[model samples]
Target: MYKYLFLLGSSLAVAQPAMAEDGEITVTATGLAQPVEHTGQAVTVITRDEIERVQGADVTRVIQRLPGTTFTRTGPMGSLTLLGVRGAPAGQTLVLIDGVRANDPANANAEFDLSQLNTATIDSIELLRGPNSVVWGSQAMGGVMNIVTRIENGYSASVEYGGDDRVTASAAAGMTNEKLEAALSAGFVDAGGYSSAASGTEKDGYRQYNLAGRARYHVTETLSLTANARYTHGKVDLDGYPPPNYTFADADVTEKLRAWSGRVGALYDVGILKLNAGFSISDTERVGDDPSYPYSIDGRSERAELFGRVALPGQLALDFGGDYEWSRFSNAPDAGKAHNGSVHALLGYYGDRLIVTAGMRYDDHSDFGGEWTFGANGAYEIAPGWRLRAAYGEGFKAPTLYQLLSQYGNPDLLPERSKGYEVGVSHGERGDPVYLSLTAYRRDSKNLIDFFSCWSGTAPLCATRPSGFYYNVGKGRAQGIEAEVGLQWAPGLSSQFAYSYTDTENRTPGDVYRGADFARRPAHMVSASLDWESTMGLALGFDVRVVGDAFDDRANATKLDSYALGDIRASYRVNDMIELFGRVENVWDQDYAIAAGYGTQGRAAYFGVRLRK
Candidate 1:
């Protein structure tokens, strides 16, 4: 399938023009707006039009189509979902919502739950792959996902229903005037879902509600103030272990989560410099309720940041920034608090044919002292239709509050560190009708944190103990090649293809699980899509995804077989204000599992109607 798609794309590109204009501009890489093709890093941008074409209800569904990305979801919608980038752990990837950190501080791994995020209010998503700690600070050992919400003046609404008693509805409205722009969106989802356990028959259910708002006021021609806020509440019925323990049955577990975030900032444009300052706060609370026991965990983060970019003489530009963050975690049993301060400086040179960037950052943590990270990237336009890019960077991740102050916590844990590099070549411009890119990268990581039982005060090899402690004793390496091709064949016909080959291994020597592949991470992944829009207001789309087999446990005891999924969607606009759409997922109803004991959705169909201004 991949070979055929590649050939088809090549044939279509042969008749394309020599030069093409750039598409949307991105700011996730270096805090500066630049075309994705001009940046040295590997980045993927998903625009609003593409999102609507795909009919994705959540961010996870859209993100899964990107190269070198994978996700594990336990059950149906509203279930716990984790994302991995380039073979990196879920916690290593940083998630940002309009420049505010979204990772849960109370979680043992400080990972963000992608399931909590819906696409009702999102305008665009910028995925910066590979290590980006130099400018993003900690928890960027894998990559960064920056979500930009809609602030344009418009009004839209949608409603849909499908299998398993699923129902979804969303509404958004915005207005723009001479000096003010504001937008607000809200969404709700409820579904009677399948059980998490493979063999369980009892039906589990999930429900969620989300609301977001953004406002910007131009104080003057040279200054502006902006504010953004979001809230999400979710509940899911969980299936516990089926047998033996009997502590809690599969039908008696439920989990609830509430999260909210708010940010306020100001932007100033001077003669030769741009300045930005912001303050933000976010909180998440999760509660697990069982017939026999109930527990709750809460986390909060407060951040203040300031940055400036100066256009210097010649082709050089300078960027400098500083930030301070305070995080707290609390539960019935214990509480923890920590803070960190970071400062970074970046320099860039943008010439006629070459672009170069270098940056360094210093971070001081209240619990673990200080650390430094650096990065360098360059891109050269070898010809009108060819370009070469290379980048090298370092990354670090701090211990989470749960890992530091919980019952099984270790106060002596060290931060995980990593270094990686990538080189790539591409044919085409930023907005070329047809473009292709091939990239190869490698990353080596050390001091990865893992929980281990400690008995008799032994090291690396410990006996069974009632409780375990977090230790920085693991090492790993990931290498991969990613290829992407995209083309707009004609007026409304387009296609995209992406393939990735990943080689990952646990290099922790002297351990029982040494040299094993990472759990839930596929070694090979392929994604392809074709879409067509007719002049008569009709659109059709098809997508295919294939994932290679992977292990479900560290010991390689359980395996998840390879699976291929196909989906088709169509939309017809009745007029300028109304549209009808429908889609079929898992068209073949192939039975598969992304996790060991979880059940995946089967053939399902949904129909929806959209109304726009």
Candidate 2:
């Protein structure tokens, strides 16, 4: 059934007429500002207008529309959410806020929890698909997702209430002058969430608060200074396994987290050279409690970087940079610190008919050693509205602090490494009403990390064998095809369609998990949306998502069936400064689960209002 739907969507996408697009600039693909059509890599940009039109509860919903991306959540709103790209593990995907890394250093896999992120203050989002380690040092084996916050001068506020007794409110204000510009924003969310267990009557609730601020000062005509900071605090009710003699009910357990990140930077521009330097820090603390036990952990990271770009003759440019990072993890009876430094160089060429870039990086880790990585990308314009692009890159993921210093940590574990390449074709010019693209790529990874059982002695099957310990004993391969189509059908009417087909397999020789499919990765996924607005201040939108069957465990013993979901939303503008909106999610109330033993939300509705100036 999904195959048929995918075919139908493809046909309609090809048959539809072009609409129109506002010109937008993206900087994630090449570390430089440029139009999406000019970059050699696949990129997706979601603007503020799109965010307001869809009005998703969280940032994950906005990301679901991109190609080669998938998400798994334990339950409804405020649940643990993980994101995967191109069949890569969640930890392999790098996340950034205004060019600053945001992954947790204390996590065993150094992965970010997407559920904790709110979209109220985001100005734009840029998703760059495929390996990007040449520009982003670590955790770029899969791709990069960069969130840019709002900085323009304006004032806005919103409030909403809906299903599960959920309440949300947010406000922002900004001002600008000849020498300085500043903005501040804050938001709050509370929800009486559903049970986390597959079958339970007790409800688990959630609460969160967030604050963010940004400012830029023009010290001189040729130099500027900027600073930004964000903080989030959240608490979530938890559920545990059923008791031996008790029925399914809520467990007396909870978890709390507080995290903050900030960065300060300066940019200096001369006629022939541009220089940039920055310093940033991120700190996170988490606490888990039950009647009998309570524990906490802390993680922190600090980094400094300097980079320069020089303009040369003949449409050529050179870029060079270096950075230093310090990471630390602390807890009772466990503490560790590590330092890393890296240098990189890139060369680029821009011409009327071709664009080319090549880069290399060398990294030195205090504990392990040193490694080198390189990449190249090229795009050629075949005609006025047609182009061909190809890219090849290498990526690496260092062992996280928790994986190397905790009780089950392995001090000798090696870093996971990968090599990948892609070739694609694109049609339609920038700002055109219709654009289409298709790409095919493959990646091979080695030294993947996993926990395995180990015995005290050299004997096999020893009775005193330890439960498990981390090891570098895994390998895998992923190959996939991606397709995307965008159309501006008419004035106030627009649509988008995206599809991904991925095939992944374990390649670890002589390992028990060899030949098994990567866990929680669907082989087929599709997303499509259509939106329309009327001159009378009325807007309507519809979206559909389809996910194929997948296994919940590495052994492939627990299977999750395929499912399709749909959503509908509408909005009416009362005046230039006021608007009302509402939405219905899972309109058909389809029974599905992204993870085994987890409960998903049913049909739910929400209503809200907004004021802007």
Candidate 3:
């Protein structure tokens, strides 16, 4: 079924550009909501049109090519998507939906699984590489990924269906006439997922369903209210290992999980002062069927944040914000809770050719006490198309409920913290068709955590298991470089290529001296793509992604070699109201794992038709 779709797409000519903006600046890292070229942080932006073309199964596949990002493989959940921004631990990074924090508080690492997010609903994603805790608070140790949903001015709807039992449908409409404007969007998605574990194995297959809705209304010219809600349910069929040399497992097991989240926000602009406030809630549940693996986990999380900025007469800007968050996790015999509060402020000085930004955040957590983060950023325009930027900051991530109070968890876990710095160079004519940027960064983490003993329920040997009790390990450091080039060589031809590399290590007291390299983080990665409009109503594109080798264990005992993958897509307009398209993924049939023990899809394809009025 998937093959036929690609075939039809290949038979078609090409695609046409949609009604999308080009080169919008991002202000996620600065906390000022300004453009990237005017800020010091290293940033990468993926436009909505690009997201529509990739149509990947998950965010990992979608942004893998972005600089300093890598992916790990896990069964059913598929690629355990991990982004190594400046070589920091995946758990140290923070992900945001709109402006709301989206990292899971129930997990040991306080990391948000990109796998759970449906990219079909995303309008754009910005990757900010560097410490940004002064603005975003905890878990921004490595970087920040801000996902912005689409907003429309009028009625718009789309239904997309493809391979691996994947289907998606979405609708968005808005009214902007008269004195009021309102917009609303809803989406649904389901997938049977990719094949991994063998038959009768202890690991299970994957099945997932998701739904999301968003709405916004303008109460007045400068006042607005927005709300968003989402629900997801997924199950993993697990299989146990195959005896003796349990180097890897191929068994099938059953794991069920459900999650729901909602958020509401209000914004008011009164010339000199712009004020914004929002509240968010999330709940999660997980159930496992196997008695040896009999597990039940539940968690509830809530957060409230307020932001305000004031403009001064002399090109001086002052921004301030505060946040309070709480979470509770329960697994019957084991339970835990955490709470934290933070206040942050930024002072910015702006000039025609230079901008300086300074900010700091003070957070007090129930478990880890108080932590303070500070950052400084500055950018200067050196010439008509060149800019120089520098940034330095401190970041942190609090331990999650699972790390603090699970069956074999450690309640004494400490928050991991880091100090980071970055510098970059960018060149591009304002509103030009070509741009190039490069950045170098380094981050060091303290009080890192790791598993120590095994599950202690039965015997000592069982506790010796790899997945047994974990504890704070010590310190580590990661450093890397990122580079990108965006070009529009002709009227209808445009291309982009980005690459990243990192050096990582775990250096702490009494830790096993394995190797210099950190496990699971590839040293090199690259992504490139080209888009072109062949005719009045046809468009064509091709994309390629590559990753280097990485270890499968902390001991660095095993390694998965590097591999590259490619994909092709094309679309044609049958008429003004109808269009046809198709896509081919893994065109090279690369048989490599993002992690050990898992098989990536070789070569696959899919087709579809789109209609518009």
Q: lDDT per model, in order?
A: 0.83, 0.80, 0.70
Candidate 3 lowest-lDDT run of ten: 12-21
lDDT of 2 at 77: 66
Put down candidate 2 lDDT per residue, 1-613, tens digits, no spaces: 3223322322211100001124656566655455676568877888878877778558877888889999988866677788899999889998877666788888878887887678887877888888877777778899888887766578999999988888988888998887887888877889898888777667888898888887777788767677888898999877765466454346776889898888877766675786666777888888887554576878888777666679899988887766778899876556888988777888988788898989998888887788888988889999887889998988899898877877767777788899988999988742258888899999999999987656433423223335556778789999999998989999999888999999999999997779999999999999999989999999999999999999998999899999999999999999999999999988999999998877888888999999999
- Top lDDT: which candidate number? 1
Candidate 3: segments with Cα more than 4 A from true spot: 1-27, 30-32, 76-80, 154-194, 198-206, 242-250, 407-411, 429-432, 454-470
User: lDDT score of model 1?
Assistant: 0.83
TM-scores vs. true structure, each candidate: 0.93, 0.92, 0.88
Model 1, 1-613: lDDT tens per residue? 2223322322211110001125656666776555766578888888888788888576776887789999999876777899999999889999988778899998899999998888887877888889989888889999999887776568999999887878888889999887888899888889998876777778889999999888777789877777888999999998774346753335678899999998877777675887667778889999998655678989999877766679899989888777778899997787899988888898998898899999999998888889999998889999886789999989999999887888777778889999999999988742358888898999999999998766535553233224677889999999999999989999999899999998999999897888999888899999999999999999999999999999998898899999999999999999999999999988999999998778788999999999999
Q: What is the lDDT of residue 505 in candidate 1?
A: 92
Q: Which stretches of candidate 2 lie over 4 Å from their true place?
A: 1-23, 245-249, 428-432, 455-467
**Top model by TM-score, which number?**
1
Write down the worst ten-residue block by lDDT for model 1. Answer: 11-20
Candidate 2: lDDT of 264?
A: 79
TM for candidate 2 is: 0.92
Candidate with the larger TM-score of 2 and 3: 2
